[model samples]
Target: MRIHQLSSAIANQIAAGEVIERPASVVKELLENSLDAGADAISIEIGYGGLNQIKISDNGHGIIAEDLPLAVAAHATSKITTLDDLYAINSMGFRGEALASIASVAKVTISSKTAHQEHAMMLQVQNGQHVLSPCARTIGTTIDVVDLFFNAPVRKRFLKNEKLEFQAIELVIKRFALSAPHINLIVKHNGKLVLSLPAAIHEQAKRDRMAKIFGSSFIKDAIYLDVERGAMRLYGWISGPNYQRSQNDRQWVYINQRMIKDKLINHALKQTYDGMLYPGRFPACLLYFTINTAEVDVNVHPTKHEVRFQQPRLVHDFFTSQLSAALQSDGQNNTEQTLQDDSSGVTSSFNSKLYDVAGEAINMAYSFESTNKTSDVGRPYRFLEESDERYESNFYQNKLELAEPLTSQASYVAPLRPLGSAQAKKNLYSDIDECSWVALNNQYSLVFIEQQPYIVDVLVLQQKWLLEQLQQASTPLESRPLLVPVRYSLSLKLKERIEELQHYIEQLGIRSEWSIKEDKLLIRSIPIYVPYLDLRLFLEAVADLQCIQISSLLELMSQMQRFDPKLLAIEERMALNQFLLKVQNQKSQFHGVFKALSADDCRMLLHV
Candidate 1:
């Protein structure tokens, strides 16, 4: 076949293939035209998912009676005249191909009456054929596109199901609704009103409109953004970390009030939300960007869904810094509030007699240690020395085993049993309400409540305590300087990502630096509590942070060591007992991450 110039009707049908992909495309083009014509309010009606009939009425500046024919003509636009105008175009519908291409494939009837005109003029076109006539009165434009894709049978075959098409149409309407909150929009599908958004002229009204569209739950977790850099201004609502969705469909990005899907902007957004969200989850956001008309090319795509930026790098950096700052600021607020609440909880806990005794005992023990600092003994010192009369039971001597010391230079030392003298035990158990506890096999505690013994997993209490400590820590955990720095080799990409997140990583108590000569990452410090953490697993988990949180790493650190009662120091065991006592008194049972028997369970055991 030889190359030849396509006929006028074939050319238009080809253009329609690009612009009119579905009913949503038609809605988008018509809405843009309405918005470009300065419509404050618009109404849309759809039938059979816009395949049978689609009517749009808008109170905008109507086309001139003479220009009505030109409106349906190819390449004729009131928005732009020359190629130079494309560089600085502002109107949403500049190519003017929408009406002409749509008219070529569908039955189009455009009726309008300018404010000065007494009667409206109606222009009807069917497959490039036209008819002009005087019609009833109307102050604005009313376009009825019936039997869409009537001439293009192949295109009609590609149309989606009615439900899917209607969903797409609603999605497009929602995009414009968010972009121009001041535009009152009413939408009907098969005579049932699906959406009716009033004009949002004020900030409160705009927020209300957003809540209506996105839901109140999203609004509760949304952070408002307004950032400007040079010719670029970014403003909108971004969902917080807690408001992530399973899909990216919830993300709405707009450039100069025109909804778009620019990969550059989306990549920047992903970078901002890298460590903030979980894996395979997307943040629900409505981001509006305003840049100089000359700085952006909105004609990059036929559907106007993509744009080319003059300085893509600069825009990307601006978005990253501004959005990061906003999220970080919100996080800091939450952290401070948490710290305050924890402080209040500590103060309240001091009012309890058992809690006060624990605090006093710990303080007195620390004071004793400060005075004994001059002693040169290498062995671990006991906070509470056992009396000579308190005999070490076979349970402690035969069954207990000491854990390996944390540091390489240290050697494991046998742990001393915490059993007190007869008098001390009597004093401790006197207020127990006919209950007694005996450490069972060093793994469980058999608590005899009202003469019935119930087994309890001590590890459950330990896990709960560890979680509470990790979650409510007012300051970062204590970190120890490494005697020899740990080195990790990495690919260039992973290295760059780590360097980008170096600041955040350091804040989490792991200090790392890139070795210039060796070309490997050097870890200089680590949390003191988790001395045996697997550095490779920790770094990889941190690098691939989408699946978990930074705090989760700390939780992992705590979990690496199994719960062991014999390994705990005397003070720690006492503290565990105090915690369990509190739980029993408050709730009559301990309900930890692991299920432990309750007081009711203890009673049920006696019955059985």
Candidate 2:
């Protein structure tokens, strides 16, 4: 094949492959451009999951008559002109690919008129081909896109189902709405008003807007956040410590007016609420970050949903510190208010302040009836034989009788103390000499240096184990056979990397090939040592491993060789079974496990 300059239409179609991935992508780009243009009110209409048609009208600064034609032209944009402009790009569509790319895949008609002009101009284009010149129109810009992917049949087939696609589009609109509470956004799906967020300027108004979109209950459980670092500012409402959802859908983040999925920031938030929130639950947050445009790069991805920050560590620290401070402040305020309210009441009691903090409310009517009963008070206390031989024999017989039942129960019972008596506190600190290693619950090897629960990071340990197992399993000396061959769909870059390192993989006696039919890399042979292993998960781990440097890979490989597959499997199974048993025991014995950790334990667990 000879290299030749592609036509404008072909070039735009190629760009469309990246920019116009789906209906939602188109909506995101258009909405972002409207926001960049300072639109205070935006309205969106979609039909047939935005495939049949999509119309977006924004009351922003409309384009001039002459500029209307250039708006849909390739590489033509008002966002950037100079070389330095790329470094400090504040606008969302700096590349100017969205309009042209969208036009290449769909029929687009854009009508606009400046606020100062009496009439607007409309231009129509079909699949990168101009059909009509600028014509007169009403005020504001109304962009109508119809027959999306009409020119690209292959791309159209890749779209999801109608409901799923609509959901994706709705997600984009909600994120944008949250990002710009001052902008009124109305979305109509198939002529039905799916969402409507009126313009809100006050913090309460914004919270109400969010409640209308997410849920009304979110307002009561949300925490207001506002903090600023050197050059970065963070302001938003986050869900309280106990307010959590099952997924990350509610976690909205925006950097400099552009919505993004930043891993560092997400991790920082998780660290802030680590022990405060339940496991497997995510916090609902509407975080907005403002920083120098030059400090971050948004052009790294075609979708512009991901960004690279210059000072990721600083940003992470700032997020954790600010979020933690806000939550702590709320806790202190509530505590102080409770104390003040209690002090205002006149109650005759010994150690009034001490009792106030830990007082338990009693029903006055019930207490008066219970006070008349004195005969049953003595019946509450009972005495048993205290002779050593008799007590020891009873204890032994009870242990023998209860062994099977206790094992089935899997419940932990604390030793009881006499009522109204001074209880001795157990020493939490451990002596170094007495810190003998013991297998804990048949999983972790506990060596209590100072009575703190300690274990290696689970993810790191799992990865290390996997690496060692793969190495040994690849050896031809093993006789195990896999029941199923795992196939992995990888990016072109990752596929190339695998092929480059095929020699190393073959040395482990594992067979692999590129499956052109599925557009993936297929693992035809597995390591004999790990026949039960899930190959898909292993391949994903491999891809993650490839993301790091060669030195890190070598280090990982070395560390992985030390892992024992049998021991790993045993530990995993024991941990899982223990968890199941604990859940069952809790269901039978207790209402729920609301174990409160001591201040020292909290500090240790949170690494505070």
Candidate 3:
């Protein structure tokens, strides 16, 4: 074949392949254009999951009659003019490929009436051909797209069922709605009103809008965060430890009013909840990050769902520090607040911060930033303290519940005197010896270092040990073949999912073979770590392939730790001592494990 320039239609269809993935993609682009046009009120109408027709009406400044033709022309945009504008882009539709691409694959009609125009001018593009007509309308714009993927039939096959596609479209709309609470937006699916959100005029109105979308439970269980570091500000509601999602679907992150799914932000948020949550569980977050436009690049991705920060390290560290500070002081300094009724008639309020079993607001945020104040990154993190209220009066009334029982030896250790819970003190033991250890109540161990005693909760120690073992395991853990292979009958869908995750499952030391004839899966072996757990129940619980990872192993170990350590033989006790010694040598506080008491704390607990 001779090399020649492709036709305009072919070129546009190629661009559409990248910019348009599903009905949600089209909705995103059109909504972005509406937002860029300064539309405060927008309405969306979709038919048959947006495959048959999609209409978006926005009450914004309409385009001039002359610019109507140029609007559908590729590479023609009013957003940016030069290369520098690309780096610090403020508008959402800067690339200008959306209209042209949508026109190439579907029949599109855009009608507009500017303040200067006497009548509305309509432009239609069908099969890559253009037609213009004059009509009467309001002083705004309405774009109607019909027969999506009519030119490119192959793209139509990629679409899911109408129910699933509409779900995706609804999710996109909700994201935009949350990102811009000032906008009055309504969505209709097949003529049925799915969403009707009025413009949020006050703080109460904004809270009402969020409650309508995310539900009242979220507001009740979430921690309100407002913190700033340098030029960046992170503010939003992060669900407390009491509330968690099995998947990260509820996480909404917006940077400068633009919804994004940047991996850096995701990782940073997940890192914040390091020890508080186990694997496969996600905290519901609605975070908004505001940074100077020049400090971040939004043009990195075509969909603008991802961005590259100029100083990613600084941005990440800042998020970690600010969120950590918020989580730390959340329990002690929380103030009660109520939400006023909105026009929607739904009102909800939060009276108290979510507290953990320890009676402290669960601090999921772990500080990962460097500790050195003078060595580069900046100052050490300091939490905001409430001076108005003193520490909780019931601090010593609550007992620290140990998740596991301690190993007891009457001959080798001294008796433990009852002590109340000590006020939280930073850092752990500076000096210690094995001779100063004493087991207390078969729940915790008291260790004296430098003539000061510190409490070690056995449950915390067991959980930490189990988590480390699972994470450090060499992949493809040692497996033991079963004497009689276990068989499980499963649905076709479940069988397919198991087949898909066969590779990961094997890495955890479980081997399986499919028996299509019997509609069953034959398990050949089991991982040595999870021998006690019911294999069938475990397999069913880890149905999601994403859960079949180190997290799953950790979950299994946590379950195993529930069995008493008192059952172990004397030989086992010797081995356990070596393990405990290793833990003592390595600073426990540094790893989110147990923290030892300072000398001052020891005296306070003893009433010295």
The number of the candidate with the highest TM-score is 3
User: What are the TM-scores, per candidate, against the unseen true structure?
Assistant: 0.59, 0.59, 0.61
Per residue, candidate 1 scores C-alpha lDDT tens digits across 228-259 of 87888999888766455546887888898999
Better of 2 and 3 by lDDT: 3
Question: In model 2, how large is the Cα lDDT of residue 369?
Answer: 12
Error of 2 at 514 (Å): 55
Return the clash pairs for model 1, or none. none
lDDT of 2 by residue, 413-484 (tens): 110110111221111111223232344332234333234333322323334334433443323322222233
Q: Report RMSD (Å) for each prediction in the order shown.
A: 23.2, 20.1, 15.6
lDDT of each: 0.68, 0.61, 0.67
Model 3 collision count: 0
Query: What TM-score quantifies how close candidate 1 is to the native fold?
Result: 0.59
